[model samples]
Target: MSQQDARIDAYIRKSASFAQPVLEHMRALVHKACPEVEETIKWGMPYFTYKGQLFCCFAAFKAHCSFIFWKGALMDDPDNIFQQRGENGMGQLGKITSLKDLPSDRTFIKYLKAAATLSTSDLPPATKKAAPVKKALEVPDWLLSAIKKNKKAWATFDAFSYSNKKEYVDWIVSAKTDATRDSRLADALTWMAEGKIRNWKYVK
Candidate 1:
């Protein structure tokens, strides 16, 4: 049987007065549509899980409440309910400040039920996702010159993984001052000469 989470109850109770009703309305439809859905808090907000994955989540902000179907990207948004990728927070319905800002109860139930159904489906393929691809890390000329000074360091660096090389590059470039950058480079070269990856302390 579907039931309310006391934590979710407390979350709504502590939210702003205006948001209380919106949260309550959404919460009711979630349970109504999917009696087996489970509710929990994730990233400081309420989320629903079905079929072992995050199905949807909601949050109360200072001026608005955000709601999202986590797998909405994979679902058929025939009503165009989802906004363009990366508009605000994780929510696709936009900022729901008032109950009127939300989609109608029937539409919401459709979304909730669809989300539950999606959790059991194969879902969207990773290639269709809108996420940006990471660019290849470039070795700065000055840092390259320093590494080349020691044959052992250069040889070790040449064989490092892209992520390992990025770690060294990022560490040196992220230094707040010239002295700090140079110090990091010197330490980085020394570690590399000994055939150590960046973040060697965490290596296990």
Candidate 2:
């Protein structure tokens, strides 16, 4: 039998009433699949290891719990089980709010065994290639002039990351009509001058 951690006991105990059963069930399933799996605390969550390699992990969040294979990104998920939602949405397994959100125990065991097997074997050789480098964003003259008018906004825009700056540029450039472009430009400048990103509303 795998050694269970006391910390995980407290973690499950402290979890929301709705999440305790889910966490306990996942821990049982992982042990069933790998009896020798060792338990430890990682990143402030419960993680399991087999032969010193990460086996799997589970975390309870404000609304959901995450139980994911450590080698998931490299695994072949034929069932398309990994469904990412937003920047952080319980990794590839989607939000595991309940047992219905996950596959059957046999399916999970299959994934775990495959990951354990892969850990003990060398992966297939791959042809390595360098990733393409992205170029700096080109700010339009009119937009630049508009931004320059607001000293604080110009400083903020210049200091913004490439993706952040690109959001404003893409919004203005993608406008279908000149009138629409002018309107978006005005809105973009107003938001930028206020030291806010284009997607500020979406940020937590």
Candidate 3:
């Protein structure tokens, strides 16, 4: 048996006239495709869940509607129906203004079954790649000594966050000549003593 939500019914009724039939048809198609599929509202949109996990979601905007698979990036799309990544639409199929924009009922159900299979599988859904770790910044001994010579500069530099400290260190280290390094170091100590970060000039 399929579970449906009254809130979704009201939602469809409240949608723009052009989107009502499109939403209704898709809603029926989802239930027809997966008899065990359960419906609810998530993020103010109609959400379908299967086997205790998110199956998919759909929303009707002012001018168009969208249908998204929860694990769309992991699904196989041999039919080439999915929108290319980084496109404008929030849904895999892009902005669906009418029924003609959708794949045939058979193809749509096939992918719906594929999504249901993924929900039933033991493997976890795909996650974004982990951000790369930033390497530790090493302060040059001469720069350290120069900062230490001024108690206020040392205090300010010591209080700076890792990112703030890294900015100053990176700027000084990237200097091409010994003279430029010394000049920047002097200016850096002066700014630190005044409790200013590197690139303070750009700050509003």
Candidate 4:
């Protein structure tokens, strides 16, 4: 193993455990496959690096461990091993509780090696581009009047971030009819008067 791999092993051995053996075994398998792979902690989880780029990571949760391929959405998984996570390019091979739950040693090693090769070739995974930041719009006179009439609404709207402010304004402005806009304005004002965002009650 490289110095980085040794350091990662030491770190894991010293850390608290939920699925210690599973993580360690997976780490060992990764190192065995790509001896040049460097290890580091990212987002408070163990991540592997090769050619100065992220290759993979593993995290242990309450009941399962996830092996995350940074570019999992791009890899060819003929065995259907990878599980896509929503619209994101990220994926995981889930429910990894122990060595037994993993692919065979050889298959696992092959995948790791393939990942390293792909990294070295500088082929990045296809991922959804982040949406551009939306700017906040000026508060309409009608909306402003509603806020002014409700002191609590004015204060709540003033406290909102630009994005949150824009969300409320956009919702009202997007209404097709004057009646619809007026109705939405009333509801929005009521919520704001309660010191809440558009969907504050539903937010976690």
Maximum-lDDT candidate? 3
Displacement of the residue 104 alpha carbon in candidate 2, Å: 0.5
Give the higher-TM-score candidate: 1 or 3: 3
Cα lDDT of model 3 by residue, 1-204, tens digit: 476799999999999998999999898888988999999997788999997898788899999999888777778999999985421236889998999999999999998989888877776666667798866669989878888999998999988888999999899889999999989999999999999999999999
Q: Write out the backbone clash pairs for model 4.
A: none
Q: Which 10-residue span in candidate 3 carries the lowest summed lDDT? A: 83-92
Off by over 4 Å in 3: 85-89, 130-204
Judging by TM-score, tell me the better candidate of 2 and 3: 3
lDDT of 1 by residue, 1-204 (tens): 486678999999999999999999988888888888888987788999886677888989889998887766666778877764332374778888999988888988898998888777775522344687766678888888888898999999988888888899999989999999989989999999999999889979
TM-score of the candidate numbered 1?
0.60
Off by over 4 Å in 2: 85-89, 121-204
**Across residues 1-204, which tens digit of lDDT does each residue of candidate 4 receive?**
866655556656765475788888888898899888888987777888987888888876667777877776667776666666422312367677667888888888888887777766666666777997867568878777777888888898888888778888899989999999989899999888887788787899
**CA error at residue 70 for candidate 2, angstroms:** 1.5
Write down the lDDT of every candidate, Cα atoms only: 0.83, 0.79, 0.87, 0.77
Selected candidate, larger lDDT, 3 vs 4: 3
Question: Order of all candidates by TM-score, from best down to worst?
Answer: 3, 1, 2, 4
Assess candidate 2 and give its TM-score to the true structure. Answer: 0.60
Per-residue alpha-carbon lDDT of model 2 for 1-204, expressed as tens digits?
Answer: 677899999999999887888888888988889888889998788888888777578888878888766666567787666785221326557778887887788988887777666655555312235686867789888888888888878888998989999999999999999999989988887888788999999989
Candidate of highest TM-score: 3
Which residue pairs show backbone clashes in model 2?
82-92
